[model samples]
Target: MPARAHKRFVLSDQPKKPVATAGGTFRGDAASFYLPDFCDSRAAFAIVLIAELTAIVLSIARQSAAVGFWGELARAALFLLWVGLVSAALLCWLRPRLARLGVGPGSVAALALLTLVVAAISACVSLLGHSRLVASAGTGAYFPRQLWPFVARNTVIGFVISAVALRYFYVTYQWRRNIEMRAAARVHALQARIRPHFLFNSMNTIASLTRSDPALAEQAVQDLADLFRASLSDRHQTITLAEELSIARTYQRVEQLRLGERLRVHWDVRGLPPDARVPGLMLQPLLENAIYHGIEPRPQGGTVTVTGERTAQLISLVVRNPLGERQAEREGNRVALANIRERLALLYGARALVKAGRFDEEYIVTLRFPYIASAPPAGGTRPAHAAPGSPEQ
Candidate 1:
């Protein structure tokens, strides 16, 4: 059967733009969300420099009323120029240099170097322009002391900004990782639902043939052993559909051996991507439910058909058994369907799905997942397997 496709991958946990001051977490400050203080330090520095220049212009205007507007306008123009030059040099120039600087660390060294460069650029251009403009304005003379103090004030602001920005980002990262770990753990716990039903069923099947056919009985025992071995291996908890199917087919063979022709099986398997993943032993219990509730009850015998197909962007897997009016009274079968649906939700969040109902005369269970033809290990560069060619548009 082909795998079902779903589109849950487009959703992301991170926000579009980082928030300042209160940090970027959607979680509120009332609950202790990490503060975006690191960039706040840099942002504070930027704000401080602008404030100092504004003050200087204000002071100049008071002394020479005619040049007030000119002083304010000049500061504004100079600040704009300072920002353009620093942004270009930091984002374009300094960042590329850091790559070669062998500054082996988180991009912190690049950020620090960029901050220092901005401070230098802002300090030089603003101070020089302030001095020349003040001297020419004729309201008062430009003094080194005056310009240096403002430059020093803004530089300190820049360093503070750096510290605040780093802190917020660092904490945000830690927060996200912890959430993912906890979520993964919860899903793993739900996986324990793979119960002893399969084991007991296998033993029962073997016992039915123990005296009737010794050779077939021996083969059933071996098959049951292999299925249990594969299922119980701690390292084998999660397996691809191909692997899971292999195990299921083995178990199904054991069932076939005991039940003989009374148990009919039909596979309408197509379109499944071999690289697709599934919960370990995800299908066995559902199959078992079909056998116990659908096949065994039919005195004349019937066929169980399993189908997998791609439905638009999602992968859909459906198991249909010969069920007619009997479906109305099959309480045990309904429980199996509910259990599988809960497991899908717990395992894949909203990405996975399950359903059970009557389609005409057949009782069916369908499951769907966002199709990832080939999904490698998370963050790893490997690819998932899909159909030989690309999927239909």
Candidate 2:
């Protein structure tokens, strides 16, 4: 919990990308839908097995043939199915908190209590509905007594499950931390590739104009300073879409200083959720890909367009660049898209994803992820990602 809170603290002031504040909620990508292996089916199945066996044992001990083998198994199966359904439903809300280790022992105990309540409700149904079968088998009177032991056993089982869940939380934290470190390293490498090369590229552009336009050369140097600083700031992994776009826009401005009449950028943002989130430094890398692979190769650079939208369940984003002449699939040099996709998978599970491809004359990449946001207060629309210009401070 401390670790998770610390992480939140670290990212507290970062910029928020496009998002919608539903009520007072701070909504973003569904990457928060990730859940680890704490909830195991085998364990749940075992709980049902014990409960039904207890019921059957009591029925037979009372000389009642009502709760036969199949009947007992059926009852157990139903109870467990109830548990599964309830947990699955709760996951939609609980998943985000769990991803960041926000769930604690108390939360686990509360869930246990809820499960127990459901269990009791199921017990009442069984008792009332099957009274005749139970009575004829001489087990009706002892059924309540049989329930006590299962209840007790189940309570202990719940505790065990909670303990396992805590362990899984720790394990997941470790796993996620490892992934973050690797991504940070990769981003660091990419930043290096950008700056030295980008600086040199800009310097060369300035050098070409130094003889004819000294004032423009000086302005280029200043733009280059702002560009490098903006490009290689804190080196964190996640950022709001707004922060990334802010940096991207700044970087593009710097590029314009160098590429005068060739580069163009347009935004098609009609579909943005207004509170979407994305990896920090994500856009810059892809933008670099656009500049280097597409624009640099062509003497007359093309346009880069960014589009974002939201469906009922997911946030969708696509970046399109118009520079695909030959289009031989360079299948292997796809680390940026690959790493980003991997991170999204680990963060969002299967619900959030990204895909990059090329068609006839354009290279495009798209991202789809579940939309998760902080809960909103009463009587308010969804909130923005955060304050702008306070760009991920």
Against the hidden reference, what TM-scores do the models get? 0.47, 0.46
In the range 105-163, model 2's lDDT, one tens digit per residue, is 33464456545655665566456545787778875533444555656665566566545
Q: lDDT (CA) for every model shown? A: 0.57, 0.56
Off by over 4 Å in 2: 1-196, 209-215, 270-275, 328-333, 343-349, 370-393
Give candidate 2's whole-model lDDT. 0.56
Error of 2 at 76 (Å): 39
Model 2 weakest 10-residue run by lDDT? 17-26
> What TM-score should be assigned to candidate 2?
0.46
User: Could you say which candidate leads in TM-score?
Assistant: 1
- Give the Å shift of residue 99 in candidate 1: 48
lDDT of 1 at 107: 44
Position 382, candidate 1: lDDT = 35
Q: Write the per-residue lDDT of candidate 1 for residues 1-393, one digit (tens) a residue.
A: 112212222122323322111111232222222322223357456545664665566566555444455565565445644553454345443433443432234246745664676567666755665575766876342322365666676567656755665565556755664565445544543454334665676678777678877788798888888777775664324566666566667767877865678888886655775556676666766677677667877887678887777667777788888784365666555555544444454345456766676677777888887665445568864332233323574
